[model samples]
Target: KADAKARSSIMLKAEAVSRYPSPAAPLAYGTAGFRARAELLEGVFYRMGMLAALRSRALGGLAVGLMVTASHNPERDNGVKLIDTDGGMLAVSWEKHASELANAPVEQLNQVIASIVVAEKCDAASVGTVLLGRDTRPHSEKLSAIALEGVGALGAAGRDLGLLSTPQLHHLVRMTNGEKGAGPYVGDTAAWNSEQGYYTMLADAFSALLSSGGDRASCSPLWADAAHGVGAPKLEALLSKTPQLQVAVANTVGTGPLNDGCGAEHVQKARLPPRGYEAPLAGRDRAASLDGDADRIVYHYWTKDGSWRLLDGDKICALFVGFIAEQLDALALEPPISLAAVQTAYANGASGRFVKSLGVPVAMAKTGVKYLHHVALENELSVYFEANGHGTVLFSDRATSALLAAKAEAEGASDEARALAAGRLLLVRQLVNQAIGDALSDLLLVEAILALRGWGAAEWDGLYEDLPSRQSKLPVKDRTAITTTPTEERLTSPLALQSALDSLMAECPHGRCFVRPSGTEDVVRVYAEAATQADADALALRTAQATWELAGGVGEKPTGAAA
Candidate 1:
């Protein structure tokens, strides 16, 4: 009953499935996707490729994406995040299918995949294209090629775009599935959606913002720590397109290992200069650090009084909220546009208050960019950020349309204020990476804001002093035993652990604490903040002590634990 092409396709997929057998241990496709050691991911990559191809077909043959990178993970480790048809994380609904396919036995692999095809209502003949990209890792190319083979096995086309940052690949996938045109298209899609187009898009938007604000900035040079990964060359290329700002880049590829004492994670968590900048940093000089794949970024600097200040996602949110609130106020459109900021529980308490002072309600979501992104969609204009410096501002279709309509109506009108506000808002929308949280795009946005206000990192930090906070993770025998409330602001499971931590928090002034299992690692993360640095550090230490006492430590038996 089947044609030669269908049978041949079946054989190809079967053969491909046989080549990479799943590991004995089961793996789940969590928010971070199926991440593990690079060697353990051969089977995962092939199956994910098939999943992405199927996802494309499920969405009427739009291009789905596969990004190969472990982000800030060590160089020896790598993972993949499946970019959905709309250029965001793969649909949460499909995550179950991904996990089922990933952990399926070799003997049942073909049947499992077939069942998925039937369940998703994907026609065998409706094979679609899968766009692939990878970071600069030793084994990334090989893994990406294997994923492409998986795509081919499904009778789907595969396009491997070598060495792209995670967000770049996301942008291109969105462009491929979007409407056709030139620069500045409707909604969120771009006209020229290639690597060059990404740079051109950001550069052009930066120029437009500068023009709208008046002139270029003459601020001090900002140093960029590249994490010695794909972001090094990519950032260089993006900056070459903009000749106005002076940025000194270090820790480039071949200079050091990926995320080895550098990158946004190191800078934000450790609160220290990256590997290359071990020397004393001059006061007033600002710096930005990007993780391996360049999807996350955090800025830091030392004050003149010898104090180091890190402008984390919380700080960035405050600055953007203030500036965007000003722009929205300037436009003052009828019916008034709704604006909000979305953050995870890891966000500083002071940040919530700072934004609230600007009359913008802040919403809290579970950890992970996908969760925050979904919450942000509720507002006309929403800024979402995690404490780790991974997030973006989402402009809804209605919000964008309003701005566009305002711009058109303001044409030849005597309202210069309306015209200028519309111009800045439009450019800001373009400057942001709506597809995902993008580091380079975020850096440019910060720079543009500072230029407009003629302020530096100092002024941004001055918005609100952050409560001292510390994040610690303890290896657990079984991390799943740890759980939290929906907001992750309180621990619900293991009442003893929660009681112990609550007591610890009560001892410190303005103290707050919570614990949750890390999505990507086999450990439970504890976050503690207090009014003073010593109290914050001590509170984090005490929480770990409490957990150890209750769980009897990782290796030892968990004596007092109650599920």
Candidate 2:
């Protein structure tokens, strides 16, 4: 703890010195930042210090910090991002400067930094402070040293809160920056943020559902794979509410995260139960894995005999949409509150139809949460989901007002009337719960719905789930060279993109196909939702092949970045 404090002090001092240095260029922010290629750690850090200094000045001399080093990304991939005063991502527009800083040449970068100092009326030698934090990856420590050097060179204080989870760093950043009170505390759990109001909302809704359904017997257990990121610490706060809810957590300890062996990206293999073919358990044990950031989930459930049945992101969305719709019907609610499920082009066709069948509206958006967040915010959507397991629901003031007004109409209503009204509201709450897109949250939702309907896991998702859907990541060498440069220019031209989409349309019922360059990796992901597993696989592979062919081996080049 003392060592940590000392490092923090050093970083603080370093930050103050670097205030006057010009930033490299503007940093672009996507849902996450355009991840810094792994080999570019030095470049990212130098740029991060500049960006942090700029933000500090922007916020009226508040000390800002940089979380440099990609959490859970590959060894060759690194990221530099800032946690806001409230511990959430900064506004998208703010990242624009960071992107600029990243793209600027060294000479111009120094000038830009100098200019920022002039603009802020601060001496080039006396900028504000910056804090530095890193995780457990082997590269992380070395990266920290280099970043600290940069920060120190700029006369900014660089603190090393060595070996903390990403979220813990987030919390510390908030508190140290005056967003929260000083803890003066150290150790694993002390630094965890208590502002997990979002997760709490989901739990409260789930608890209400279980209570209403007469399934208040006992809270459910949570078996989670945190993927050794920030998830475990944040989830700990959530589990605190329902003490009866047992938690069997794995992969909770580690420095490096987000590898192939852990998280939602890892496929769970089916296990055969003991006692040969006549074993009481016929299928394999099932589990869910969360990615490094803990925002994504991929589910694995067991069959009657114990065989494993994997549930992807789209299926998870479908189950919630369908369940919520029926619950509303039971309460005699009409039009079902105009619920909207926002999906990406990659979502499975059956899942899309299933959501629509539940009497809810659907909107399709470009890949990634940036666009989805905008659409949800603008449209006042009741819910939004992504097939990649990244989603959030909008509890818009308008929607809440509508719900409250409806409740007022139910005042003095009989027990039956109250139940009906409650059911309708519960349906909306369920939509929010599922829309969190966190796997454990999804599991809780599924279990609650099952209890209400008296259905088992298999029966809960409704009719046979249509057909086989398959997704695979195909390498596109030098995908960047084929598209654009300086990172931001990589966007595919509309004409080219539309042409590809048109060709993919031919694979229908065979499944919908789309090409997505990974936000954090080099490979492009191809997804297909078909009427048959074979068809889905073939179509997805073919489309992927076609996309690469069109790119003329652009994606096949060695970008040397980590996923």
Candidate 3:
């Protein structure tokens, strides 16, 4: 009888599915997932809803996630991405299957879904759940509603978690599917699985970690720019959970569209403060920006010399990995757990060198959190951060076991130092959202680390000098024409373009440059770094010029003083 209900559900959904027609152009799941103008995404969302439910059924009724957000994209745009049972982005191998399902013709949709079920060995008749969350976009609510219908079509439950950040949804998915933590951050704990529980967990972890590190009183006030999206409300709710951090949030609401002139991408790429931050940040006045869905973050402030400075993912990783390594060294456990740092090709040359100096191996991956997270998981404990501020620390079962055992022995021997060291790492794991990179969670983390070190924003920047670097997007007739090697640090196709780009990069002292298609948008991204700002800008411009001329660029050439 249950199987009959499930079979009929798919047929019932076919009628509703016909309402949303696929766009004239096909959609491909990119580094994140399927994204496009809001008008073109309804069909994708409904299909993803079914896919999410099927994924859950395949994994034995474990809940999956569907987040209706376009991280860092403009309000005119929206997106939907599936979260796997592990709370990470949908598995890479299955991305192609999702693409196939999304692009299937409406008439043949059920057949395609059946094909995926058979290939993936999914029990389509099994009941499952999909947790749905949406951003602040006007269309997000309606899109999520359509997705819910698709979930019902599969005879699966859809728990709608309205208006949540990207990472929040990922957290709930992992927790609902039974991810466990050592102490209070438990998956089976029903409270920790709710949106409010999310805030409470982050707040409690921050409070404990800060109090443990001594003098939380001296902590400096930090303000987070909310990017006029769901992060503002989430940050406010976080404040309700704990009052320890002397911080304030701004850009809580905006009359204009979301991320119009604010966000981590704007701050890091455009080199300007987000809107509503008219007052210049100086001295120890630390500030951070969150993208649309609040997954990425970048810290910034104005230097005394009136120069603006930004601390991005590379800096975040350098600070975090160095601190974690120091804690491990202090513990001096006989079964010392291994740790490393993983970065994409976009990381600064100096940042990698600094992490290597701290005695942690730095591994390179392609430009995506999924790639970096998989590579970092190889070690017992690994830190992965993209240059754009999308990252988090991953703790494997091996690391957790070692730390717990070491702490037990230390306690037995009354070794206060080792016990505290081991405890600190555990507390950190509790504080961070291990599911994915979270801007809100990361804000608490950086602040707590600074308090422990007695270091201010300027002092953190003083740890390493960034070689001047520039990142820009060159418009092209077809971004797909460009391809790269595995690392994405070097281009492989268009031999003529690659030849010209290499020559241009070699001309600058300490120059490094790469060009590749942006997985999220319709442009070719170019990056260059050099010993000085001028050289970096010039090299970037030259390489973009090579791509423009060789790879069929659009519009007028990118004119700049460097050019």
Q: Which lDDT value does model 1 have at 119? A: 69
Q: In model 1, which range of ten residues has the least summed lDDT?
A: 554-563
| Alpha-carbon local distance difference test for all models | 0.84, 0.54, 0.84
Query: Which order, best to worst by TM-score?
Result: 3, 1, 2
Per-residue lDDT of 5-108 in model 3, one digit per residue for the tens? 44455555544368876666888896778888999988888889989988887777788899998878889888999998878888888898889878888988
| Residue pairs with backbone overlap in model 3 | none
lDDT of 2 by residue, 310-373 (tens): 5666766676666555544554544345557777776667777777766787877667665665
Q: For model 1, how does the per-residue alpha-carbon lDDT over 303-364 read when each residue is reduced to its tens digit?
A: 77766678888988888889899999999999778999999999999999999999999999
- In Å, residue 278's CA in model 3 sits off its true spot by 4.0
TM-scores vs. true structure, each candidate: 0.94, 0.70, 0.94
Relative to the unseen true structure, what is the Cα RMSD of model 1?
Answer: 3.4
Candidates' RMSD to native = 3.4, 8.4, 2.6
Between candidates 2 and 3, name the one with more favorable TM-score.
3
